[model samples]
Every structure is written in structure tokens, then in C-alpha cells.
Target: MTDPETLAAATVVVPALVAALVWVLPRTWVTRTALVGALATGGLAAALTAVALTGDRPLAGPWLVIDVPGGLLVGIIGAVGLVSVLVSPAYLGAAAGALVDPRRRERTYYSALLVFWSALLAVPLAGTLGAAWLLVEATTAASALLVGFSGRATALEAGWKYLVLTSLGLGVALLGIVLLAAGTPEGGLGALSWQVLPTYAGGARSALVVYVLLLAGLAAKIGWAPVHNWLPDAHSEAPAPVSALLSAALLPAVLLVAWRCEQGLEPVIGVGPARDVLLVFGLLSVAVSVPFMLRPMAWKRLLAYSSLEHMGVVAIGLGFATPLALAGVAVHLVAHAVAKTLGFCLVTPLLAHAPEAARSPVSGIARSSPVLGGAMGLSLGSLAGLPPSPLFVSELLIVAGGFQAGRVVTATAAAVLLALAFSCLVRALLELTLGEAPARTGPVSGSASASGSVSGSVSGSASGSALPGLRGVGVLVAASLVLLLALAGAASWLPASDLVDTLMKGIA
Candidate 1:
């Protein structure tokens, strides 16, 4: 095997080269070629992850660093990206109104997807704050196109909303980065690198200003409340594969950037203020998502709100900044990624079989197709924090960590919020699996498409173009169940593991 650094670079480069190749490839060859590239990208990323996890220290390159947290993220992005590519052929086959010219539609979609995948792959491994920020911004452009790929008025509007909102938030973050750089002793791009930021000499007032600006800006991109107005619309409007990447890969990758910021600045600004900022964001996000979850919203829309809630959980775990919480955050990240991806991937089959699910709650999914229903059930159940699911264990660890950190009230409040959210999701699960099926009167009148429009119908079915994709989803669901259970089992010793100790020591 190649060295870790070489693997890391290849992970980002292979997809990019594929993106370029797909742009010029014949329409007939786009999906096949893209899949090959995706396999290579995933292989390299997974190899790098193994190298990082086994090493005692961060594996550093000139432009990249594969630390434990970064390694986990790379692995998640690789897995999610590969699955997205796997499902893209099915999506494109059934979809219409694509934003690009008909002759170039396949090439356009695959190119944008591979480009977006490459950028997400790079963000976790970025060696400096500036590079990470640039890579994240690159994702915005590529994914916004994917989000609006349907070319419908609603899809286009949602895409534009996502682009504008995230860009604005990133702008604010850029200002904060500039401020930090100006105050650093060496006063260069290198000063803003993760390794150097911990030694920030900036005074308390300046540091506080920088911290607020950074967190507030990152909050929008992470879909944290108050700045998450674009999240629901974008997630609901994008293609199923694209939605999975947004919720599972993009959100957490950006959150990692925020985590790095906190670690870098804590020594300069004091832990109290930094921790408080994160806690506020986390609690507010959870509070905001609960009421929405209780409402009988659309399927993709509900998952969108759930993303807000789950990201909040991870944020709170980060804020607690204890060994147990870090461990919980780790487990939660992997569990949430798997569960959320499965949920979104199911949208293709769900929408194809029952178009009405786009506007109202799903019902009796199990009665329609056993495989589809079972997968949907597992996805929702896992998200709801049911026992035997890793999320349940992770949440417990987070609460315990909060107490260990001496924030009893905060921990208590978070636990209460989580319980309330859990009940809401459980109710949703029952309604999803057991509620009476909606009467399909002819073609659905106002059935929303995966693209967030009401015009598209079930152009394909489980026995049609979507059949292979549904089979793929079934395989993913089975794999996820075993993986999540393994994570739950691993939680027993994760808190005391060397990785947790390394994280607790502060990566910066």
C-alpha cells in the first residue's frame, strides 16, 4: 500500500480527474466511468482512514492532515459518495427537467457529483483553516447545481437559496479568519494553520469577537438554527443521492471545521466562552427541530429537520468537551451518517411507489413492499434513538459527559430535549410503518417529486427503473444495521480508548 499521505492526496485527486473525464465522456459512458472513479476514490480514502486510526499521532502531509477525527470523516465521505454514485444512474434514468441541455445531462450530473465528492473529500484532510474554507466553498457551488438539477422552478429556487445563504455565512466566517490572521504574531497564512492557531497571542476581546464570528458563520452551513433557513428547502429539493451527501457528508465535514476552530482558540479565549457558544447553538438547534418533527411534514422535509436536530446533538457533545462526550460524538457521527443516508436513499423508492409521501406523512410502507418498508423502518427507528441503536448509546454518553464536565443543568436540559425529540420521532415511526395507507386516487394530485416539484410522477417503480436502486438500498440497510450495532458495542470501551485521550488532549 502507498504511504498515508499519498493515499490522502489520491483520495482527493482521483475523483477530480474523474469529474473532468466525465465532462468529456460520451453520455453512454458517464455512469460506468463515474462508478469506476468512485470505487478508486473510496478505496484510497478507506485506506487512509485505516492508516490514521492505527497510528498514534496525526499523519501529516504538506497540505493535509489525517488525524483520527479527520480520518473518520474521510471514511464517511467516501462511503456516502460511493453510494450516491451507485444510485445516480437510477435517479437520472427516472428524472426529467434536468438543468442542463438534454444532450449533456448525464455528463453534467456526473461531473458535478464527482467534483462535489472531491471537495468534500478534501475538507476533512485540509491542513489549514484557509484551505478548508476554500474547499467548503467549492462544495457549495457544485452541490447547489446538483440541488437544482431538476430545473423546475421550485428546485431552482431552493438551489439558489442554498447557495446564497451558505455563501453569506461563509463570508462571515472569512471575516473572522481574516481577523484571527491579522492578530497572529507571524501574521501569515501559516499562522492560521491548525498547528499554529493554538498558540494565538490575540487578547481576550479580539479572540471573543473572532470566536463568535466563526461559530455564527459555521452555524448556517452546519444547518444550526437561526441561520438554517436554507436547509429544509435545499434538502427537500435536491435529488435523493444529493440529499444524502448534503445531510450525511457536507454538514458534518463543516462541523469538523468548527470543532477545529474551537480547539485552536480555546487556549486563547478560555474554555468557558467557547463552550458556551457551542452549547447555545446545540440546544437551540435541538429545540427548533422538535416541534417540526412532531408535525406531519413531508418525508424529505422531516429528514431535513432531523439533520438539524442530529447536528445539534453532535455540537453539544463537542461543547461538553469531555472524554465521554467526545466518544459519544464519534459514535453519533457514524451512526447518524449511516441512518440518514439510508433514509434519504429510500426516498427514490418511496416517492416512486407512493408519490403522495412528498407532501404528507408516509403510511403503511411495510404493507406495500416488505424490503422497502423494512429498510424505512430501520432507518426511522435508528434515527429515533431506539435501543440497540448506536444513537441511543451515544446520547447517553453525551449526557454523562455533560455531568462529568460539571454542567448538570445544561446536561439535564439537553436530556429533556432529546427525550421529547425521541418521542416525536417514535410517533413518526409508528405512523410511517403502521398508519393506514393513503388512498391513491388516480395519479397523485399535488405529489411532490424528489426535486421538490409537483409535476413529476412515478416515472419508475420497484419493478421498473428504480428496482436496481432499491436493491442497492436494501443492501445498504442490511450493512448499516450490522455496522451500527458494532458501533454500539464498541461504545463500551471507546471513552477510555487512546483515540479519545488524543482528542481530549486537543488536536491543535
Candidate 2:
């Protein structure tokens, strides 16, 4: 068998090479090439994850390390990227009518997606804070194109906003990195490696300042509140595949970088302040998202706010930083990735069957299309933390872990906030999947006027053919539901297991 490090490198390289190939390939071959590349990348990532998780020691080096956190995240990025690629051809087909130039769109979109996937795959494996920052900065450029791919006024505006805001945020992060480099006497890139930074800079007087700078900067990119103004618009406007990558892969990958900073700085800043910063951000994110989740909005927009809520949960788990909380973080990250990505993937079918859902909340979906409705319900239900969902299990562990960390007051506040968020989400889920669908303005099929016109029947058939890929969505949704259930069942014993013990050891 190949060594884990080679497998990890291949995961990043194969997609990148495919990206170049797609950029110049004939439009007819783009989808086939993309699918093959995505499969190869996902396979390599899975192999690396298996080694990192099941091996006796982490694979560490000056540039990359496959530790517990990195391994879990590598698996997530791979899974989400593969699913997004699988769904892309369908979404592009359904959206052909809206494109200015379909051929150019195919090449540009696939190339950008591959580039974005490659960058995200590298972030978790980065051994140095500097390397992670560079990888994250690379994502902003590629994803901006994807967010604005539709060429509509709103999409263009949303894409620009995403680019500007995230760029400014990264600027702040760069300043922090410069300060960190300045503080270390060795003063080389190696000094900023996770293993070296803490040893050299532990006693630096400016540690607190660096911590604030790093976390605050990363918050914007992570879509954490106060700085997350770009999230909803971007998610809503981007194509469904891109939205899945953003929510399930990009956001959590960036958060891992932030988590690494916290670990690297903890020795100097002490645990209390480090924990407090994360808690404040986590609480604010949960509190901020509930109102939006309650309001009637487009399906993708609602899921965007839900991202805020879930990211907050993970942050709180990090804030607690106990073994159980860390275990909860692991579970929450994977569960949220699967559930949220499924929710975004369903949007392609949702829009195909009802274009109105792009701008407004949908209803009577279960009544109209049972498969689409069931899939949406499962996705939303998992996100809402209903019974037997892994999110519920993970959130319970996080709150319990908070109390175990002796953060009783913080944990109590978080519990109350989580309950409120859950209620709001459930209300939204009901309104979305079960509420009365808007009354149709078109003539009923039995009406004499409708029965007399063959054009209407032809039109319906054409529209249905436009999204024939929807049948595949049902298969994906069924698989996601089964996977979520298995995770939930496994989560029960996670905190007491050896895996959790390994996670409790800091990422560095």
C-alpha cells in the first residue's frame, strides 16, 4: 500500500491537474473529466483519512500533518466535493436557459470548482498557520467565480460582496500572521509551523493581541456573526453545488484554521480568555441566526442561517475544549456536513419543480412531489435537531461537555439559546415542508379550456425533461439519510472511546 502522505498529496494534486485539463477540454468532455477527477480525489482522501484515524500515530511533517482533526476534515472535504461534482452536471443542465453562453460557463465553472476543491483539501493538512492562511486565500478567488456564475445582477452583486468582505477579512489575518512572525526570533516560515510557534512565542507579551487578531479575522471567513454579512446572499445566489461546497466544506475548513490558532496560542493566553472568545462568538452566532431561520425565506437562504447556527455549536464545543466537547465537535462537523450538503443539493430539484422557490419559501411540496418533499424534510429535520438525528446527539454532548469544563453559566446560556434556535428551526421546517402551497394561477387540468390546448401539455413535458437528473437526487438523499442515522447511533459511545481520547490531544 502507498504511504499516507503520498495519498494526501495526491488528493490535492489530482483535482488541480483536472482543473487545468477542464480549462482547455472540449465542452462535451468536461463533465466526464470532472467526474473522474473527483472520484480519484475522493478515493485518495478516504485512504488518507483511514490511515490517519486508524494508525498508531499521526503523519506529521514540516508542511503537512494528518492528525485526528485534519483526518476528519479531509474526509468531509472529499465527500462534499465529490457530491457537488456529481450534482453539477445536472444543475448546469437545468440552468441552461439562464446562461448567456453555456459552453463557456461549463468550462469556467468546472475549472473554478476543481481549483476551489484543491485549495480546501490542502487547508486541513497544512502544518503551519502560514500555509493554511495561503490555502484559504486561494479559495476566495476560485469560489467567487462560482458564486457569480449565473451572471444575473443579484449573483454578480453577491459574488462581489463575498469577494470584498472575505478579502478584507483575510487582510486582517495577514496582519496577524506578520505580527506572529515578527514576534518569533527564528523569523522563518518554519517558525510559524504549528509545532514550532508555541514553543518560540509562548512567552511573547503580545500573545493576547495576536489571538484577537487571528480569531476576529477568521470569523468573517467562517461566516461567524457580526462579520458574516456576506453569507446569506452568497449562499442564496450561488449555484446549488457551489452552495454545498461553501457550507459543508469551505466554512468548516476555515474554522479548523481558527481552531489551530487557538491551540497554538493557548499556552500564552491561558484557557479562560481563549475559551471566552470562542463562546462569545458562538453565542452571538446562535442568537443572530434564530430570527432569520424563523422568517420566511428562500430555501437556500434559510440553510445559510442554519449554517451559522451549526457553526456556532461547533465553536462552543471548541470553547469547552474538554474531551467530551471535542468528541461532540467531531460528530457535529460530520453530521452537519452531510445534512447541510444534502439540503443544498435538494435545491436543484426544488428550483426545477418550482422556480418560485428561488425567491420565496415553498409549500405543498410533499403534496406535489413526494420524493423531493421527503428528501427536503429529512435534510431539514436533521438540521433542526429532531429525535435520533446526529445533530441532537452532538449538541447534547457539547452542552454536557461545557458543564464538564466547569463553564456552568456559559453552558446554561448556550442551552437556552440552543433550545430557542431549535424551536425556531422546527417552526421554519414545518412552514417550509408542510405549509399550504401557494394557490396556482394556471388553469386546472380538467377545465375545458385547458383540455382543448395541446400546447400546455407539451410545455409541461418540456419543463419536466429539463430536470431529468432529479431521479438521481432521490438516491443521494436516501444514502444521506442512512448515513446520518448510522452516525447518530455511533455518537452515543464516541465520547468514551479511544477516538475521543486522541482528539482531546490538541491538533498540534
Candidate 3:
């Protein structure tokens, strides 16, 4: 067997290779092509994680850094990619039924999906900042195709908007990279490497500008507010599993880029200003997403807004820069990924059953499909930071860290935004999961007849009964619970004094 270090490159490359295979393979083989790609990537990610955790010093190539953080994120991207692929058949089955020519476009859809997965893996593991940025651009292109796979006017519009906005954002990021590179002793592409930037800590102005530009540019991709106009549209139009991968995996990949830049700049700007900027943006994103969540919309769009809220929470925790807060950020990322993916999965059946009315309407959820309804409820509750969910622990840690950092106003505002967002989510879920069935008439009913067939049957059959797929819901719920338990355990096992000491030592 090949050593894990050697396999790291393969882990990143395999999905892209599979994407090429999807394009070349016959239409009948698209599903198999996606499965092969997902499995290969997943296996490589697992191997990389095992080696990084157990080996003396895993891969450390000139263009790749398989450290603990990189390994953790790469493993997560791979795991989420596998789940997305598993759910793709059902999702695309529904989509194909809705599309004009399912057979002709199916190959394109699968190819783009595979490419998106590959780009996601590359974003976190790329050793050079420029390479990571380029990978993010690739993901944007791939996702644009998937977003528009339906060939509807709305889907095409959303795709174009996403492409334009993200391209502009990346252009800004590239300029930042250019500025940072120019400041380097060797200059040009040599300075673009993550390993090289820290060596030039003396150039304070250049480092600060680079940090600001990178964060702002990446914030658009991360779905931060003010620049987040494209998120809801793209997410609502894309296939459910694609939406899940976008929310659960892609957002965090961009964040890893932001965090890397933060680490490089902390020595120069100090933590104060850098943290303040994040806190401000975090607060704004939460504030903006809350009102949208309050308004009625499609289930998937609602989930997209929820993603904005959770990403805000992450930014807030990261802004604190305390060891406890950083740990909370990590925990929140994992919990949110699992919970959001589960939510997207549940929404799939809901959309199929309810369809879109002139006004958003949901009915017969609990009565017709108790398992899915319950799963949706639990996932939304977890996202809203309700008790016993890992998000609750993570949010509390973030708020505490904010106070400890002496940013009292920011902490207070964040708490308020969180409360508002939670309330809005609860209200939306209640409407969807507990209401009576709407009147079945008009075009809405026709669309529902077409879209809701599978969900209605599944829900009707599964009520007062169990199905194998329900096991997936159980896994999601259990994962969130375990995360909360782990947070509690870590709190007790690792003393605050030790944590502070360790963090400070790393900083110094």
C-alpha cells in the first residue's frame, strides 16, 4: 500500500479525475461514476486523517500541508461529499422529473457535482494561498452549473448572479494576494505560499491590508451579509444534496482560508483590531438573516438563511480568538455541518410533499411523516441553539469568550441577534411541521402532485412505522448529541488555566 503522505495528493485529485470520467462515461453510467468518485475521495480522506493523527508527521509537501487543522477539514469535506453523493440519486431523480430533458443533462449535473466536491477538498488542503483561492474560483464555476441544472429561468438567473458576485469578490481577493506578494523578500508567487508569509511579519501595513482584503473577499463566498444576496437564490434553486454540500462543506472551506490569513496577520496587527472586524461582520450577518428567516419562504431558502445565521455565529466565536472560543468555533462547524445537512435532507421530502404556493404553505407534516417531521424539527432546533444541542454549548462559549475579551457591547448584541434568529426559526418550523393541510386546488396542487409524489408516499407509509432511511435521521440527531456531550467532557477535563496557558504560549 502507498504511504498516506503520498496519498494526500490523490485525495484531492481523485474527485476531479472522477469528474472527467463522468463527462466521458455514458449517461446510464452517471450514477456509478459519481459513486466511484465519492468512494475514492472518501477513502483517501480517511487514510489522510488516520496518518495525520497517528503518524510521526504526515504529508508536508511544498504545495500541501496535511496538519491537524487541514486534515480535520479535509476529512469533513470528504465525509460530507460522500453523504451528498449518497443522497444525490433521490434528489436528482426528483430534479430529472422536473427538468425538460433529464437524460441529456444528467451527465452535466453529475460532472459539475463531482467537480464541486473536488474543489471543496482542494480549498482546505492547498498549501499556498493563491492555490486555495484558485480552487475556490473553480468551485464557484462548478456550483454555478449545478445551480442552473434545472434550466428554469430562475435557476439561470441565480447562477448568473452568483457567478458575477463571486467573481468580483475573488478579484478583490486576488488584488490582496498581489499586494502581499509584492511585499515579500523574494516577491511574486514565492510569497503566495502560507509557509512563506509568516516569515515577513515585519511588514505591518502590507500584512494588515492583506488580512482585511482576504477576509472581506472571502466573506462573500462564506455568505456573510451585505454581500450575501446570491446565497438564498443559489441554494433554493440547486438540488437538495448540492445545497447541503454548499452550506455544510463549502462555507467552512472559505472560512479555513480566512482563519489561515488571521493566523498569519495576528503577529503584526495584534488581535484587537482583527477580532473587532470579525465581530462587527458577524453581528451584521446575524442581524440581516433574522428578518429573512421570519418571512415565509421555501423550506430550502429558509435553511439557507439559517446557514447565514450559523456562519455568523462561527465568525463571532473566531473573533474572540480565545482558546475556548476557538474550540467552540471548531465544535460549531462540525455540529452545524451535520445539522444543516440533516435539515436539507429533511427539506427534500417536505418540498416534494408541499410544493410551492403563491404564499409558502406547509401542512400534514407531523400527521403524514412523523419521522421526517421530527428530524426536521430536531435539526432546526439544533441550529437555533436550543438546549442539549452542540450549538447551545458552542454559542455559550463564544459569548463567554467575548465577555472575557472585554467586548461587552459586541457580546450583548450578538446574544440579541441569536435570540431573534432562534425565535424566527422556531416559528418557521412550527408552521411547516405542525399545521393542517392546505386546500388542494389550482396550479399549486398540480405542481404538488408532480413534486410531492415520493414524499407523500414515503410520509404516508412511514407514519406510525419505521424505514431504513430513518436511520440516517437518527445518525444526525445522535451526532449532534454526542458533540454536546464531548464539549461538556472537554470543559471538565481541560482546565481553563491550562487552555489559556497553551494558547498564550502558541501566540508568544
Candidate 4:
């Protein structure tokens, strides 16, 4: 097979095998094996991205294929997935440390995680809208289970809500897909394949209906407000690592599909109809997230609303369809993935020391856990669109791109709303990290923990391995910084950046 074919094949195959292997492995191997699988999957994506950079991607075909656009999504998904998985152990171990018998639960957790990971890996490889829809649905199934992995009442409710809402949305989207198929030659599915589908879709009488249904359905999954009820609940209730995947990876992947559909139909239905739908969804989403963000809530809940806002920004960027706006979409997608991953992962460590943080924000990380404080602060800052946060740069491009597209009024409104969000988010972060410090809390314990792990575990490992500190979360903090820097660099000066620009312009 050619290089793209090989990379594309491995993209799905390796994750499938790893998921199966990890499921049946003895307890000791579940976490470690899953981590390895995550890394391997990410490595393959990175290699594929490098190939895409060289402008030698495979043609979009009947099944798995590679091109600049697909390559970018694949690369971001894998990289973000790896980050989430690396931090999973810490979150899992913390949860385990609180359990009397964590082995069984750990097995179930990691197995579900691999399944979710596999589904996430399949999305960009899909060759047809039908196939992409199936992959997106598969993700909901696998991830709903992981969202409620703890099986707590809230987690269970979050999982149920996520499944029902997203499934209903997907059901609508499927109808649109069928209609899209009918719009083809003699209504055959062949014309509905990715390559030909778009050209055939927008000319039919049902084009507007198809576009609206598809947008509504995708909006629910993408966490756009008016249909975003599931987002905050699930993101807040799920384990931190899973939250990262849902927000950073899954949301964007689903959006990628919707983006393809939008661009596909733009030719026949007219760009105005499709673009307007995205703009409405985008505006409402940004507007809705701000009020929720301003309210004092749990850290993850706050971040969850932020996810909604960022998704809105992406929608706006895609709708504008200008070179700069599209580039902003690409930049923001990666920056948001990395920054949000860092933000959610920090919660795991925070919760380790202070479980009450689940319901309310913890104050004074800056004074006590300076490393944690600095990292959390950095994450919040980045998310708030501060300088040094590539999100800031991306947002600028998006607004400017909108203006350049002759969308001055809409761009102005979005900019005003985003500025409000930024200010409110900064205040929220200060409340989380700079206010009164929570009393140094005691740790819970029943299972094993690393040395100096936050729980009842001792400072030194039984095997004499070194540990970070009372929290043992410093590693996560440090990793967040590194990722933040990497994200900034990639936005400003990566070798593949021109490739990203080309891909972005295609979407535009």
C-alpha cells in the first residue's frame, strides 16, 4: 500500500486492536496499555500530517483516505487524544485511590476509553457522509459510557442526557442524509459519497430542507446552544480526561463532518442559506455561553460553557469562509483542544486534594500549589483569549476574516460578545485561583497510589520510585505548559502550517 493508505489503515486498525487487547488484559496492563495505544495512534496521525504537509495526500476514495483537510483533523484528534489519555492515569488512580476495589472498575473504564478512542479515530477516515454519521454515533455510544464511568447519579444522568439528545439530533441528521441521497442520480448512495455528494446535494428542491435538518442535527452534537443542554452537564460530570476528549476532540470531529456537509451543499443551495444557518447557530451559542460563564459554577461546568463558546467561534469562522477566517478556525481548533485539555486535567489534580471543587471552584492555588496555580492560571488565561494564548490570535483572524467577508455587523456583535466573555472568564479565573484558599484537605484512600500522591498514600512509592509532591499533579501542570507552548508555536511557526492554511482555505 501507498504511505497515505498505510497510515490511514493503521489509524483505525491499531486503535481497534488496542481496545480489544486492553479490554481482556489483566488489570495491571489496562491503563499502561491504553496509554501506549493512545501514543501509537497519535504517532501515526503525526506521520500522516507530515505526509500531508508534503502535498502528497491520497485522493478521497470509497473508504479510508488521506488529504490535507482530513489529515489536519486526524492529527489534532490523535494529539489531543494522547494528551487526554496521558492524564487519565492520574485521574483514574485518584478515583481508584478512593475505591476499595478499583481493579474491576479500572478494567471497565479503560476498555470503554479504548472504544471511544477507536471511534474518534474512525471519523476522519470515513469516506462518506453516511459512514461519518455512523462513526459519530459510535462515538456517542462509547463516550456516553465513559462519561458516566464513575456510575454516580450525576454521571449517569449526564450520560443518559448526552445519549438521548445527541441521538435525536443524529436521527434528524440521518434523515437529511437520506434526503441528500435522494437528491442524487436516481437516489443512489454512490452520488452521496464524499467526493460526489456535495456537487449533487444543493440543486434539488429539498436542498434547503436538507441543509436546515443537517445543521439542526449537527448543532446538538456540536454543543451549540438552543440544543446544547447536554454539554455542560456531561462535561462537568464525566471524569476529567473523558471531559477533555469530549470537548477537545469529539466536538471538533463532529463539526468537521458538519463543515464538510455545509461546504458540500454551498454550491447548489447557495452559500447564503448554509452560511446563514451557521451564523445564527454561532451567534446564539456565543450569546448563551456568556451568561452561564459569568455565573459562579464548578470549574468543569465553567469550562463546559467555554467549550460552547469556542465551538461558536469555530462555527462563525467556518461560516465566513474567508482565508483568514478558515485559518483562524484551524488555529482555534488546535489551541482550544490543547488549552481545554490542560484546563480539565488540572481539575483532576485539584479534585484529588479538594473534592468539594466538584460543586464550587477552589480558591488560592496560586499561593499553595504554585505550580498548579501557575498552570491553571495559564490555562484560564489562554481560554480567556489572552496574549501568549494562540486563541487570542485565532479569534482576531476570525473577526477580521468576517469583516473581510463583508460581515461587519455580525463580526462586530461576535467581537463584542467575545470581549464580554473574556472579561467575565478572567474574573471567574481569579475567583478560582486567587481568592481565599481552601483549607489544605486530607486525602481519600483504599487502592494504591504513587508516592506523595494526593490521597492517603505516602510520599515515597513502595517500589522506591519518586513522586512529585503532596498532590503529585505537578507533572500534569508542567505538561500543560509544554503543550501550551507547543500550541503557540504550531500556530505561529510549524513546518506544516502552510498545509493547515491550505486545508483551512478549502473549508472556507
Clashing pairs in 4: 452-459
Off by over 4 Å in 2: 97-101, 200-205, 440-467
lDDT by residue for model 3 (1-508), tens? 3465477778878988988988888888888878977898899988886665454443545577666556667877888888888777756655434333655576777778888998898787787788999999999999988777666677778789989998899888888888777776766666777767676644776677877888889988998988899998888777778888999999988987887777666767777877777887789899999999888776777888988998889889878877667667766787788788887766444555445521254655665567666777777777877777778777888887788788888889988888888889878778767877554321111222112333333233435224323445466556655754675455433326443333333211
Better of 2 and 3 by lDDT: 2
- Candidate 3 local Cα displacement, residue 76, angstroms: 1.7
Best by TM-score: 1
Arranged by TM-score with the best first, the candidates are 1, 2, 4, 3
* lDDT of prediction 1: 0.87
TM-score of each: 0.95, 0.94, 0.88, 0.90
Q: Best candidate per lDDT, number?
A: 1
In model 4, the Cα lDDT at residue 330 comes to: 79
Candidate order, lDDT descending? 1, 2, 4, 3
Compose the digit string of candidate 1's lDDT tens values, residues 388-428: 89999999999999999999999999999999999999998
